[model samples]
Target: MATIRIGLDRLPPAARAAVEAHTGPLLTVEETAEGFNSEIAARVTSATGTWHIKGLRADHPRAWTQRREAAIAPFLTGLGPALRWREEVAGWDLLGFDVLNGRHADYAPGSADLPEVASLLCRLGETPCPSIELRHAEQRLEHYVVRPDLRFFAGPHLLHTDLNNANVLVGDHAAEGDRARLVDWAWATRGAAWLDAGYWVIWLIAAGHTPVSAERWAAEIPSWHTAPAEGITAFAAANANVWSEISTADPDPWTLRLADAASAWYAHRRTG
Candidate 1:
């Protein structure tokens, strides 16, 4: 799902006009090369202020992601970028957010950023799931988890299952603790409190953490410590299957790497 790279000037006239109404003529545009689903993704400087603008064509396969992000963003508290405004013009949907000035998080073992990531996970654990109906863990993983145990994944906690390092930002601007922010909420779910940490372990491995070290990182979140081992086992097996299917379907370098990581973590859990 490659997003079409588009700048402020690339937007349709109506869409461009709608955005410029809030932000004046774009003085500078810095386009982003990452993200799997966005036709327009960039940081634009205008007379008003800099805003991170992202959007997709109305009929694109992943167009709903922008809407989902906007719908759940307010409930995120401080977890992700604030959605200042949104608009649809010329068959494209767009969103504007206050640009965050932070580096993408480093997930390497022993990096100081891990603690901030853990802290953000802890903060999210405390956020009661919003009333918005979200996919339950069991439902979302139904195809992957063999003999799925509904009890193992039951809960009402909001879960940000996709914690890719790129979606996280860490910086030294905070008054005391490490400053970290989570983004890309399209895959956010409602599940047991421990599920997000469980998912992070896979990403940690993908970023070069041995399974033991990755589990150590997961342990930093209180929910991880208290999570039932059976639930963890279920999630591990399910995720391994999910990643395997993704790798098989795409076979892209990243998908292959993550498949291996998920398999490695599953093997670790099986042995210990």
Candidate 2:
């Protein structure tokens, strides 16, 4: 479920003061609506520089997510937006990230951004999983997947399991390698190297590709080959179940789309 978004102006005076201490005078504040989790999401500019800020109240139920992102940010150099600073004051926990000059990746068929996304995933595969506390992929899907199939998800790999297109930013600047960068690390997991590729398959299907076509795109990531056929099948089925639950509870159009996509992939995996 989406959190009720609040503008920077609504922050307590102490919290606002703390943010200004880092940003200098706030020249502009553009509240963004792309993400679902953070109550405070916006881009701010000052005499110094620009930053994308996200925050939640210290007492919020999801406050831990801010800490998770902060903890995981250091190891994500070259893969995600750099975390510039973090503040906890006046009951709010906030993170400021270097602003990237880019747009959300388009997942539609034949989009040029596809190759860039694949390249990003390739780079991510080479990053070693940091020994920080993180969730295991199998444990997350334990309720939806057959217990015996959990072995397929066990591996010492850093996995950005959320493959939502909104989480990917692609810059056309060739000097910057034209790579798609990932954001939103609150749900980062430790899992089999291949699992992130599998996650992308569902998003591809949601973007209008047939299940076979989606799997073909997944193959672009080298780690996809490490996944056993049966394991992929199990993962597909489990995701179908997960999305079913998600859509049933929220019933949002995007959730329904992903649910349909997951089902389509599971059906294809079963018969193929």
Give the number of the best model, judged by TM-score: 2
Instruction: Residues 13-111, candidate 2: write the lDDT tens digits.
Output: 999999999999899999998988899999999999999999999999899899999999999988999998999999999999999878899888998
Q: Per-model C-alpha lDDT, please? A: 0.86, 0.93
Tens digits of per-residue lDDT, candidate 1, 96-145, equal: 98887899899998888898999999999988888885778878888877
Overlapping backbone residue pairs in candidate 1 total 0
Give the TM-score (vs. native) of candidate 2.
0.98
* Each prediction's TM-score versus the true structure: 0.96, 0.98
Model 2 clash tally, residue pairs = 0
Deviation (Å) of 212 in candidate 1:
1.2
Q: Which ten residues in a row have the lowest lDDT in candidate 1?
A: 1-10
* Candidate 1, residue 268: how far the Cα is off, in Å: 0.9
